[model samples]
Target: MTQDLFHPHRHESHPKIISRLKRANGHLAAVARMIEEGKPCLEVAQQLQAVESAVRNAKQALIHDHMDHCLEEGSLSQQRAELKAISRYL
Candidate 1:
């Protein structure tokens, strides 16, 4: 099958990224419950921190994977554009 030239390449790390996001999602929900239950500020903050870290790592993985897999096939301008797109999140 012919690969589409315009679309970015698939990153092999996507499944791992998805799994990390899923775990973060569940953690975030639990954090909300902690808030509703009037849990200690320190505990809630720690859980929030964990959720944020998980999501951040997933995002970093995706962006790095894009640079590794997708950027290799593109023109210099395309790579710069893609880098700019992802940099806003960083």
Candidate 2:
């Protein structure tokens, strides 16, 4: 299946995005460990929710950066691309 274009080219091209994702990865691992260790379900759910929120913020940051750096001109194509990017979140 095709993934969202919101973060396309991020893994190979953007160091900052990768760094943010690595942090999120650590959060996910911690959440998983909490579940495995029989931590309270509500607590683990909260941690997982935090991870999701962090990822959403990371994606928003990436989109904002792309607007500033990759599509600075604010052209129609850029708008369309950004729409496509943002659509992934829906």
Candidate 3:
């Protein structure tokens, strides 16, 4: 949906979340490089797993931030809608 709905306040956690995502991006790039270099399957797989975990952690942090800020600011119906939308990511 909308970025404003999920990140209405751009809370303090925003920078930390961005840092996590940047790390994930770096891991993904390394994975691509490993594949291109014909690295061993197991090694590549491990790096890929790291990238996945990093991205998942970033997503979790973002959702937690959204729940903290968005839920507090909105009405009951709005909160319910936000929760429903957020659940899809989980």
Question: Highest lDDT: which candidate?
Answer: 3
Question: How does model 1 fare in lDDT?
Answer: 0.85
Q: Score every model by TM-score.
A: 0.83, 0.66, 0.87
- Against the hidden true structure, what lDDT does model 2 obtain? 0.76
Per-candidate Cα lDDT values, in order, are 0.85, 0.76, 0.85
Candidate 2 per-residue lDDT, tens place, 1-90, comes to 124878554433368777888999999999999989999999998999999988887887776666555554467786777767765864
Candidate 3 off by > 4 Å: 1-9
The best candidate by TM-score is 3
Better of 1 and 3 by lDDT: 3
How far off is model 3, as Cα RMSD? 3.0
Worst-scoring 10-residue span by lDDT in model 2: 1-10
| Candidate with more favorable, higher TM-score: 1 or 2 | 1
Ranking by lDDT: 3, 1, 2
Output the lDDT of residue 51, model 1: 96
lDDT of 2 at 51: 95
